[model samples]
Target: MILVTGATGHLGRAVLDTLLQHTAAHQLAALVRDPAKATDLQARGVSLRVGSYTDPASLAAAMPGIDTVLLISGGGDDDGLQQHQNVIDAARQAGVRRVAYTSRALQDPGTLANELMVRHFQTEDYLKASGLGYILFRNILYMDTLPLFTGPTVLETGINLPGGEGQVSYALRSEMGEAIANVLLQDFTDSRIYHFTGAAAYSFHDVAAALALASGRPVVYHDVAPEVLAARMRERGVPEVAIGRTIGFMTDIKHGQESLVSSDLAAALGRQPTGLLEGIKQLYQL
Candidate 1:
């Protein structure tokens, strides 16, 4: 059986959709914190199991007859690393043959952003310590986030952040989903790490150009220092903690390290991933 955790999330839902295309209904399971939130997926043939990465017993209970488990990362908590370890432990005890994980792109893996990748590293440590076969989906930021950047909010408020000309290895969540599904179904006897991004690399300037072309307006780009951006976010009523995290993300992206293209995702899916301009056209109907 193929079991997917965080099935209610955007990436998890896409994985479940991809899994359904390749496997039978009885062979699929989805872990959710609330079964009712998964009513639509449940009706579509996924076995719903209520569980959390923070709860080992819950993960074990959710792993019945499961040969593979996709551990989606958790967010917005202090103990996220411990939570991921809990899931890995339960998967080991449950005898799951292979486990697929969602990890952030650390680029060089030795920079300040490597701290951002701590959860993934700790999880990997636990999996290896347990002697379980595993696959890692190291995903970069998604370019589809362009809409939000060019959204009504940003449009009305104006674009303001760091990295004016900085390039980003932005990708579509759809492509990330495709890559993860491929890894889960493939015979990854040897553990593997797959970094993911769209076929093309895009920069904030490129995104601004796309938005202007799509919206038929002269959208302007505004770049600011990290502290300035944080202060502005606070003035705009963004919470202090969220402001710090947002600044950190911008700081990481400004290094332009995660902005490069990697064909690993193409190799994984056996096709080129979606491109920036094309995705914007499809999404915005330009």
Candidate 2:
């Protein structure tokens, strides 16, 4: 049977939706922290396995009879690296044939020194040393997160950020989920890493142009200094931690860390990935 962790999350739900199209629900299991939240999945015949990455015993109990496990990265309050190690160790002990992990896409791992990226690198290292067959999906920034970075009134106020002119090859989260599901359904005798990204890289200026075309308005991109952006966010009462993360992400982009364009996503989907303008129109409904 195939097992998916974080099954109630957006990416997990998307993966499960696609998996159900071509596979039997009885052949799948969902690892969830709360069984109460997975009633829909249970009703659909998928076995619910109550577990957390932080809890090794729960993970071990969830792995019996499962051949493959997709380890969706944990978020918020969890020590992500330790959590990943726990899952990896449990899967290894359970004799799962292979394990898949969702990681970020970075062209220069040495340069992208953010806390999150560091943890991903560390996790990858740990997983590699576990002696289990693995699939690493190094995903790009999600097109779905454009609004969060650009703000709600971007069309009215313009796109203002500290990203400079660096470009990002962003893909839709749902599409990435679909690609991941497609990979999981295939044979896993060979270990692999797939850089899931768009066909082209786009900058904040490109985003502005796309917005302008979609909205039929004169949207613009303002490349402000990082300190300036931080001050503006502080004025809006954004938490200091959030502000730091935003700056770090923008800085990484500015240094071309997220600019790598790859066809892995399209190859997995068997079609060209979505473009920036189309994604913008779809996201903003304009």
Best by TM-score: 2
TM-score of each: 0.92, 0.97
Cα-based RMSD of candidate 1 = 2.1
Write model 2 residue lDDT over 1-286, tens digit each, in one string.
Answer: 8999999999999999999988999999999999999999999999999999989999999999999999998874448789999999999999999989999998888877466677777888888999999999999989998999999899899999999999999999989999999999997599999999999999999999999999999999999999998999999999988898889899999989999888899999999999999999889889
lDDT values for all models: 0.77, 0.92
Model 1, residue pairs in steric clash: 168-259, 169-259
After the best TM-score superposition of candidate 2, give how far the Cα of residue 135 lies from its true spot, in angstroms: 0.2
Best by lDDT: 2
Query: What is candidate 2's CA lDDT for residue 32?
Result: 98
Model 2 C-alpha RMSD to native: 1.1
Error of 2 at 166 (Å): 0.1
Residue 48 local lDDT, model 1: 92
Alpha carbon deviation, residue 49, candidate 2 (Å):
0.6
Instruction: Give the worst 10-residue stretch by lDDT in candidate 1.
Output: 148-157
- Clash number for each model: 2, 0
The worst-scoring run of ten residues by lDDT in candidate 2 lies at: 112-121
